[model samples]
Target chain A: MCLLWACLLRVSRSTSCFSPVSCSSWAAAARRCNRWVLGVLAAAVAAGTAPGSSVRAAPGPRRITTDGRRKQDLAWSPDGRLLACSLYHTAGQIGVALFDPAGRLVRLLSTDPVEMAPAWSPDGKRLAFVHVTHSGTDGELDIHEMDLEGKTRRPVIEERKAFDMYPSWSPDGRQLLFTTTRDRTQEIYVSRADGTAPRRLTSDPSLKQHPCWSPDGKEIAFNSNRDGNFDIYTLDIEGQNLLRLTRERASDTWPAWSPDGRHIAFVSRRDGNPEVYVLNRDGAGARNLSRAPGFDDCPAWMPDGRTLTWVSDRDGGWDVYVLQP
Target chain B: MLCIGEQRQEWCGGVRRRALVQAGFLGALGLTAPQHAGLCSAVAGRAVILLWLWGGPSHLDLFDPKPDAPSEYRGPYPTLETNVSGMQVTELLPALARRAHQWALVRSLFHQQNDHGIAGTIQMTGRSPQNGRVHPHAGAIVNRLRGNPRLLSGFFVLGDRLQQGHRLIQGEGGGQLGVVYDPLRVTYDPVAGVQLGEVQPPRGVDSARAGRRRSLLDHLAERSPTPTPARDAEALGQMYEKAFSLMTSSEGRRVFELEREPPKVRDAYGRHRFGQSCLLARRLVESGVPFVQVNWSTHVEAEEDAGDGGWDNHYRNFEMLADRQAWPFDQACAALLDDLAQRGLLGTTLVVAVGEFGRTPKINPNAGRDHWPGCYSALLAGGGVRGGQVIGASDARGEAPAAQPHTPEDLCATVLHSAGISRTDVLALGLPVEGEPIHELF
Candidate 1:
């Protein structure tokens, strides 16, 4: 049985190789014999592991944001002095935090259920993000704005019984674009900077999420799964002239427009695993910027556009890293 | 009170009555004649198809939407109005939402065990596990009460075999009632064509040859004749007869052929395994099978099989459900309800769908949900259940049942009751039945 299992594993790492019809039987067999096989496999895996292994800094991709907790939705302050991110702490507590340009922890801006697509105000005085008031069953999600230097936080847009998230401020900071599920499906919406008078931007049954605004505020780029899988898409601020940027079968998501608007930095799982990729504005010259293992996702461009910061689990846990693009 | 007395009388007399019936069946098996009259009277003619969602699905994100909760607890989705006034479900279930008049939900169904197998045992057997003994599954109990009628097995489990690592999960087999009452297990991929590997005879073995072999065995039994050989021979003969009937029966063979359904009808159920399995389940019940369980993807481990859709969404709960799980479930369940109603089988067939438990109210940092057995929900449709009604309520944050919660046993009692088996009836049959049917569901 062990030899047969070993042969099966060696032949196919992906469950795709096995016939779906027989997988049910094999899965049943695996469950029945997994305990004994697990021990042997564990021993084999342990023997394969190098002794006294620890996470070491890889050659490229310098580590930037380091707090031993999860960090997501990263954005750079206009002057490049600070980084704003949705920070997750122990005991299910979550909030937004600021990191200095030198990779040091700044004060946590707000520690509530801060979720999705944190953005910096053009002048860099306030942060906009989706704050989750309650979670799981009977939960509410809304876009929130808070002063970076103060404790004052207010709902920019309150969605009473729906999910309103992924807020991205326009380059002029006068309009905020975000994604909401209030329409019963994910659609893009643009609201006033203060979160009043919101108008629906894009309407589709397919998911349209993680909207990002161009620096010039002329176009809005976001991820859509309308083509069966998620791909980068761009549209005018009025939601007209829709254009699909990336055409790969692999999912390309979380589009971050470069400051100069020449490239869009995004995450793609096209090469079997997620990696940071940068593509030119017209979808040509697509190059993988982060070639490291583990999931490299949510790429945020530094103000200079020559550098990019993203989250990676290559060190066994999520940490922010900056790469010279 | 009258019902209790009648049930008790039946139970007390049933032991001796069953023995006599067994002897008659054995005598009949010795001959080549089919027991036609006995078959009709033995069965209740009613059936149930349980779509068991193997892993614990998040109640918050499915049937029981808590839209007013905070964002972290609210999840990333929104709730939409269903056809039933004042009833709302997550947008992920748009298909089911349109058919709300066909189903009812018990939003307060819950139990203590959170682990998959342990909770599965609780849900399947409708009993809290005791150290020394195992409780019979509802199907097993049904099998014992309504014996197979040579037409079809009383209980059948379709789809992937459920197991935890290397062992079959608890409460899946016939427990205290013994293995003979266990459902006929058919492991097949619903997405691929149905092929009952072990249920069918080996290739090149025709029914005539099978009958000849049975005769040879019978001849040998007569020649040797050990003590109690009649009873053993009867049991073996019964087993052979069942297999032969399944292989030779036109209705049985046709029911397993999913291709026989129209393309539009097949597409309505969606092309996925769960959807296809549900359609197959309908065919099974339509063919007179008493109980059929179509388990939704038995690969229960969250990490390896999340894409396969067992609802243990401990990590990437939102992504996993959004990407693959909810759409198929919504499409399949709605299609099943529609097909059953259109075929006029809904009145006689009871359909139940549920996972073992619910996910935590608090969303973890991984943007996922963990196990929370404190409160959950289950859906019931068809049979005698009143549709478009919510039987119970969860707390403001969905932390626990707002009122007194319904235990797994209560749900089981309701299922049995819908199948025409009263709680007292099971008790009188010398089975350790627990919990009362939720009277509100009737």
Candidate 2:
């Protein structure tokens, strides 16, 4: 079992070079078990430290879309070429929209109303999103990753009764992080990119959704309210080391890591209303970024780490606002 | 015995309404103990818009903020000062806080049932389910007491029937009064505005043909699972009357055309489901609909999953409320109040906004509040009721009523009273429990 797990863990880390043997049913179990062992061993040997760099001061905020449609939960592609956002097509209608950095519509991947919260796969060839269906007694939320063409879709799990939503792909595109009620409550979960080999990372679920991966693939930073209030926390890929990054009585949710993994951008209500805040990996020097009036949330960092995009209702209704500072 | 406010009953201009609730009590109320005809009448032309929060909203989060309580109970949000002195709401509700003087807050509402199905039945019916004899929803009761002739149905639910999972909440319909009194439910979406899906006449079916098919209203309600067909000849006649009422009443049909309103008006209500629905409710009452219950969502737990859900935030309560629920409510509810008052409809239209119950006082491991029927809050406005007042009070921790703890029964009675239904008339209806109106508002 150890040998299988070790081999599977090695194969899992290499996304493009995954062998068929590592993707077998046993591989999922092995990877779930052996990844922790390998990660802990690797952490002890490596000087586990991230550079503490912050965002530099920059320009004013700009609106991305003015079509008057409500957009939600943005994901900046790994290549920094485009962004995928959940767009409101009409009332009771929501779909994934892909837009270039210039706010031009590259293409609408899917116009299906049930789909929401689009996240781009590291390869940029595919997009993972929440596909909501009301077939079950209660509405069901499932994660589905599809190509940009909107063809060829598959569920994250072969069969799921519990609600799954807001999927985040690993940098290597081998694993996906999402929130699921598989355990009868919403919790952070990690499954293989193919939706096999499911694993539970955190039992404490406070709905501080959207767990993002570090650029180095060593740690995963997410917002959790397990400590009485919503705050950001970082845990190693192995789930062995967990560190609280932001300490605020107010909710500091939706954490997004910069490309360099130097700074983390998260939304906070510490200043009365929600504002975009960026803090170093050590949780120091937290400063308000988007000081706009209405309420700002869902902060997504640009790959360059110089600027980020967030949604704000400052001008009456919610629109994508980009702020450099 | 008739009064407007909870206190100062007789002195509160408690004009005794006479002979309005006459001989129909036995047939309408369907109670075992028959009432005498000496009952006072309910004020006519009075309308009610019940903004059903559906799932239980958190008392600690919305109107009844426990700022002085421990972090475990207080959670994240701090209270913001409202226009009315000493009234504070969650910071997210700045819009509602600014207009606090427009509505009265009842902070000490409590009940025994924490389960969604039971508690929802309690609030909707204004009484607990007893001996399998479910009480009629407050809206149905209001309509039964005083029907609205201008509208197709006396009571209108501006959304789908309220439900939790597969099980329907017991008393959303006419209940003991019979299904004939069920609120005419309509659905509202951004693209569709307000679609009278259930009540819409079939395409190409002229008025004469529609009349021939007296079962038209029976086979209607495609959006609803249970379509109410004509049960008997009398019901069939009533259904036929309803069909012709909407088919011919162009004035009544115009109320559903939400686009007729100015762009500024629609924009002010915010471009969301709850916002648009509230606007429709205002239009409904404006057009003489006696009761309008605007359901927040069809089911209980809906965060981003459904893009909409009710106040039953068992998990992710704060996040859901902040992102999905609270701000829209603040914008739409405030807009609704402002619109009613601006149109001169506020004086006669009674608007009640409340969920079934309140959430738990202490925060749970899921970072959400559980169901708590022990203490909750609601907002009451218009209908000749005085504003800028806080009724009752919650304890320091907001775990229970600190003073003047009232049940859902009182809320129902208060709604009826505000809509011109007198207390003695309610007593004459043979209701299992007659909830007294909170006389403080008058």
Candidate 3:
């Protein structure tokens, strides 16, 4: 299997630059080769058939998990020692599952059955995530923060009949930036770290989601359908200077600002399906980073802006993978 | 001789003849009439693919965005224009938006039952049984008239046993039409592939072994198989025969080998259980199965797992749609329509995608939509139906029908009518169909 993968890799590299091949055909060969090789190595390691040495020597991209379950909302810890992601700990169950930088399970953080979009606090002592529960007459969704022992008390953002999600903490950890449907339509809001004294930021009636504070803490970036379909948008802390960064007819969402603030990594449907893409902070020099022909989403930058962790279903099921671009 | 008897199980040639004779006797007594008495033409090639989105999907957020409604009512999500004129759907359905010309939507479908059980029954069987008698599933009624191939039972339900409130959903079984008319429920395990249930022989038991066993079973059946007090003996006998055939007949079983589909085709369907099941539903209908109902999930689970949970979105409605549900549905349903069209089966196959009811027009405290049976939407395509059309209209707030309100009976009647079964034919089968076909579709 290794030899076959190696030969195919060589062939794919050789054919990629050939002028006569159409762009799609070129992509097809390379993706097939990548998927086959990565799927094989990951499967072998998962099955315990390959020793650590083979996996260490043969891989191109590191697969976080070969279980082939859907995983997303990747967040690298502030100290850069751990990764937090929403992964299925059991069949049909999704929650915050932590992993070491090398993809070893650190611990299963929450068992809420549906907690996701985890954002680690700067001190790495807590994980703020959206927990959804249908225990109420209707259902209730609120962002909650879990301490090191996986204990959650008061919600960070909970209103009587409102939804608050995608809790991105201000860089200083004194404030929480999130999107809520309280008081009015879906819009961004900033509240005290303990879910108090909330102030509405955006007045757009259009739906907005996945709000994250830029590392500099001076601006906020989110995806909204404000200009029609969903596109990447950024604004200052005061919700002024709203700038649309993407104009593709297809939806662009789930923006993760590069740690260095030079670029934004987001999921784009411009290619007709979800693929991880990177564009400059000003939305220039855009390119598809995960060009494989299937759903690739939730791109998050590592402490080093060069690496990203995302989820892809290209190998037939949702699995986490890491690649540096 | 048309046989109508107390026995409801659909049997093979000999037993079917017996039932026809009994039915003829009943017809003579004016108790029931033969379905052939109807003036409707039964199209042998016509089939129906019912994509049962088990739990109620939000009408406000999906087909009817109600963009101008109040914040509490409209929630989030904007609408986008479709290929069809004067029709729009939520941006979550971009794929479906592009292919809107290939399908039509009925915006005002409603029933009084907000509970999943009764509503599901009403939708699947056309009307709930007020007389305390379970009505046959529409598929059973369709099969009673159109008659599916013996190789693959005409009606196939792809998913596990669906239940609510700890009991199986009301109309999933064959109901009073007898266990035989009950759909052949097939479970597709994402990891284990197609779990064919009784159709597949046990491990270490290959086809040849199963074939010998089948011969024995056939001989036993010919000699009058032992009584099954739990179910009709003839029905069990018929099921045994079909399972043997599936195991023995390469062509019959190969239809299930979804891997036979191109990787690209499978990916095009979005690579999940629901998506693949849609692909399988298409394959079944294309192979001449008369009725196929693809249950979105085995059950309506409000809490989340990955994406396989039902559409009951009482909470986390937007998250469920944006994260797990909507796009995959759009991609798969669109792909199904596209594939059927490409295969030229679209004209013969009637594709209906709907849920038991719609979600609340108001967004709930949990950012989810609760069950609302007052108004909903259903999508239809193919089977001689005109596409790129909106059959009805919803109120501005999406709380009720503003124009051309239709009932679950109308939805069922539409499926049957598209499969060439008429309202009179349903009556002839001793089944009551309350709503007439929405003729505007054609």
Cα lDDT tens digits for candidate 1, A173-198: 89999877777666789989998889
Candidate numbers, best TM-score first, in rank order:
3, 2, 1
Off by over 4 Å in 3: A1-68, A79-81, A99-112, A131-164, A174-208, A223-252, A262-296, A307-309, A312-316, A319-325, B1-44, B67-76, B198-236, B241-251, B305-308
Which regions of candidate 1 are displaced past 4 Å?
Answer: A1-325, B1-44, B188-192, B204-236, B245-251, B302-307
Q: Model 2 TM-score? A: 0.72
Choose the strongest candidate by TM-score: 3
Q: How close is candidate 3 to the true structure, as a TM-score?
A: 0.76
Quantify all predictions' global Cα lDDT against the true fold. 0.70, 0.71, 0.73
- Rank by DockQ, highest first: 3, 2, 1
lDDT of 2 by residue, B353-432 (tens): 89989999987755568899999999998988778888999998999999998999899888988878886665676766
Worst 10 residues of 3 chain A by lDDT: A11-20
TM-score of each: 0.56, 0.72, 0.76
Quote the positional error of residue A65 for candidate 3 in Å.
6.1
User: Model 1 over residues B1-442: C-alpha lDDT tens digits?
Assistant: 1111112112221122122222212211211124333433333367888989877888998888776776557664556688999998876677788889889999998778878788888898899778857788898777666545464346778865686544568787667665555666554442225545334343344556656645654454455423223443455457556545444444335556566676557667764557777887887676667788988866564322322446776654666675457766887898999998998888778889988889998775434578889999999998888899998999977879997589999999988888888777788767787888888987
How much of the true contact map at the interface does candidate 2 reproduce, as a fraction?
Answer: 0.16
- Write the residue-wise lDDT of candidate 2 on A194-234 in tens digits: 88888888765344477889988778998765665678999
